[model samples]
Target chain A: MSNWQWFHRLGSPRWFYYKTEGWVPWLAAVSGILLVLGTVWGLAFAPPDYQQGNSYRIIYLHVPAAFLALIGYYVMAVAGAVGMIWRMKMAFVVMKSAAPIGAALTFLSLVTGAIWGKPTWGTWWEWDARITSMLILLFLYLGIMALQAAFQSRDAADKASALLALIGTVNIPIIYKSVDWWHTLHQPATLKLTSAPTIHSSMLYPLLTMILAFYIFYALVLILYTRAEILRREGRTQWVIDLVKEEAKKP
Target chain B: MHPVRRQRLFFILFIVFFSSVAVGLMAFALRDNINLFYPPSMIVAGEVPLDRRIRAGGCVRPGSVSRDRETLETTFLLTDGIVDFRVHYTGILPDLFAEGEAAVVNGELRADGGFYATQVLAKHDEKYMPPEVAETMAAVSDGHDESCEVVQYGS
Candidate 1:
């Protein structure tokens, strides 16, 4: 098949729904295994930071979720752009699916950050630069989700939310650069691709594993979410009816 | 241009206009509220205003800490190597508070030039230097302790 042919097939909801079934179980298993192993390695086996003691263990969940929260915004913005520019139905589904997951992760990052800060910073919250920018990120996610819900027509919801996502793209860099641009209580990043990572190999390895696992986990969850969205939107179609009948016949 | 492409371009322009205006508003608000804290060196240069609430941060200079036996009030000199200043805080300090580690002390600057701190955020951990304190230290060229040394300062 031609490249364009394969591309068109990807936009087909029926092809996606049927094709993804065989892959979901495998993705779920891999995410589960890596999460378990990384959790054990980071929480139990990894040596404590000579400074923060066991309190530093919060890095295992906090860093991965924070990293993913930032990436999720980019993902949402790109999906919205594609949905708007190309008028692709699947793109909108992907874009809509990203909002709540991104919101949840942002919430996770903020709460974990506060818990980690309490023993170290002597306070649970501060209006510091990094903290404020992160709070804005969470608000952006909530805004996207709420905007989509407020519209009565689905098409209108898709277009308006897409616009909001694009407009909010500017905040991503601000969140990433807050520590550099302003005085903040947050520490500098541990993992940098430009230079060597700051952490020890014993700690870094588990962290890298957890990060990779989170990416895989994101893909797995996104696929599941998009598939459910596809079904709800396309339930009136013939293929869905046939598929449901086929399942009934099989049982 | 085709009508579909024209609509998309309009959307792109709209986003650009909206972002610039939004960012400008955020900046103005930030300017009023943002006293991101002054380094000890800024105080040494006599640049800090003593009227409003402001922040100053750095490493707690070694051998400079003292506590009153009865009141539990603590006093110490905060330093970024090039300049040193005193901080008198009455609250309980965090567990990770230590000498040689970086910290930020937030309060008003007194007439005696000492910081009368209401809150003292010590280095959360031995390895963790709050980026603000690290920035103050970097201004003096003796930039880091263990936590920030490996970090490349700018992108």
Candidate 2:
């Protein structure tokens, strides 16, 4: 019975709000410190490439943003599925919060990649398979966001956007494997789950740090957004009203 | 499980499965357009039409690049381990363009069998290393680095 307590409490908006409230400061501090450390190490300490030179340093940002964008889509889709199947409002709030963050990260990846590509690949943009598939991913994120806004009813919006998010997951595998499957100007991935990473240790370490920082940063932002969304959706509840009163009385 | 919940679960699964099948079929139908370039073997086999603007990519064959010096005209042979073809371009090459490195050229194949490229873009591999590591590997291997052997060509 005790084991299921946390799981049951996780579905409650009030419980989630109070549980994560104490974690906000810690999450912000850790992510901020790790982000600064990763960026400084990647830029100043890491060695230059033999070929691409300084332009290759952009991987610290580009790779992490791209990695999180793809992972965030899965988060959004799974949250939507949970909401649809289990009828959980918290899940729907999470799904909604994930959409804009994923879209922004995907946009970041594209812009950083274009900046890196101009000096290395001799072009700012191309309709190559990998690049085109990534662009499609960006559009998929935007489409989900747009679909959510189109419906006036929150319930209708959740259901419609959930369906679209699940459908768009098919594009994720395509984006990941496009470089390998097609003759693209975009190079293949440096990190592989099945084998050892291709990047050297000095470069790989900072990249791993940045990836960790991005994951922590994502968690912090998701929690903040979910907390705000919970308040909005549960405003009529007594606990939320009391919370608002408590906050006003503090100062 | 509740009957309604079970029914919704099945409905969601059905949508995902059928949508994946639909997308797979569409991807298969547009296969050629999705590939960025053709390899040398495809060009050698006459699978690609001549005199049409198309993209070709392969490793730049070592010791095959020649420059006119007076003009921007440069010629290089690109190889895919199986076949090799000559590419003629009259512009500045990219910074990363070098012997034994992968490159993609966009141009038309003349009836005379030479490819006249209007644009040349350098393509790098997945491997990354610091300058010192690369230099050490280059010295230890002495002109026979494993990086050159992993050149990927279009299938």
Candidate 3:
């Protein structure tokens, strides 16, 4: 199929839903396996830091959760952008589905960061640049969710939230660069794409693995969430009715 | 291109412009509220206002950490290698806090030129858990080893 042909096909909720169904179980299995493996390797095999002791193990969860939180905002914003431009239903579905997971991951990152902070930073919370920007990110996610719900029509909700997502995209850079921009209690980045990582290979490998696991986990969870959204939005359609009947007949 | 398509292009541009404006406003608002902390050099230069709560950080000068046995109060010299100042805390320091380590102290700057610290953070680096003990906690319960040992450190 041509690239644009596939794009048109994705506009149909039923087509997107059916297409994604076969992909979810496999994604779930892979994510679950990788998450368990990465966590165990990080918490067990990865040597502790020379300084922080056992408390640094929270990195296995915190880094990945924080990574996905920023990434999810982009995913949501791009999807919103596409949906607005081409009016693709699947794109909007992807945007809507991304909100809760983004919020949840952002919340996880903040909580884990706080927990990790107590022993290292000496305070449960600091109004440091990174910390404050992350708080705004959480607010953006929550704001999108609240906006999506407040509108009476799905179309209105999609457009309003999409606008908000685009606005929030600006914050991700500020959050990522907060340490560099401000002299706060937070340290400079441990990992950099352009240069060598500050961490050892033994530890860095598990953290990288965790990052992969979290991204896959996001895709798997987003697919499931989108499928539910598809069913909800298309409940009156024949395809959904037939799907329900088929499932009923099977069991 | 059709006028309709041109209008759509204009709409996308409008969204971008709108977002930038909003972010710019937030950044402008954040500037004054966020610049509450100053480095040790700035503090020593008398840049920070006295009698107000302020934050400062530097290396915990080696051999400068002293504790009172009865009061459990600890005092350490905070230095940025150029300018140095003293920080006094009446509570336990962070686990990662040590001499020659980067630390941030927040408290009131007293009339006596000393910082009476209310909080002390290791600040710069996060010390990690031990990796030498590769096995799970089960290995410890099985009495394989008492605790994880430190290997050669790079940093």
Backbone clash pairs in model 3 (N, Cα, C under 3 Å; residues 3+ apart or in different chains), count:
10
Q: For model 1, how does the per-residue alpha-carbon lDDT over A1-251 read when each residue is reduced to its tens digit?
A: 48579768878888889999999999999999999999999889887765677888889899899999999998988888878877888888889889888999999999999998999788888888778889999998899999888999988999998888888888887788766666667776778768777676778888888998898898898899889889888999999888778888985
On lDDT, who's better, 1 or 2? 2
Order of candidate numbers by DockQ, starting with the best: 2, 3, 1
Residue-wise lDDT of candidate 3 within B43-151, one digit each (tens)?
Answer: 7888778988888877777678999999999998877666778888999888778776677888988777789999888764532334453235336532111111111
For candidate 1, give the lDDT of residue A25.
Answer: 96
Point to the candidate with the largest TM-score.
Answer: 2
Between candidates 2 and 3, name the one with more favorable TM-score. Answer: 2
Q: Where does the lowest 10-residue lDDT sum fall in candidate 1 chain A?
A: A177-186
Pairs of residues at least 3 apart in sequence or in different chains that clash in candidate 3: A46-B131, A47-B130, A47-B131, A48-B129, A48-B130, A48-B131, A49-B128, A49-B129, A52-B127, A53-B129
Per-residue lDDT tens digits of candidate 2, residues A159-247? 99899888888888888988878778998889989889988999999999999999999999999999999999999999999999999
Could you tell me the lDDT of residue A51 within candidate 1?
61
In order, what are the TM-scores of chain A for the candidates?
A: 0.96, 0.97, 0.97
Q: Give the alpha carbon lDDT tens digit for every residue of A106-189 in model 3.
A: 999999999989887788899888898899999999999999889999899999988888877889888888777777677767
Q: Judged by DockQ, which candidate is best?
A: 2
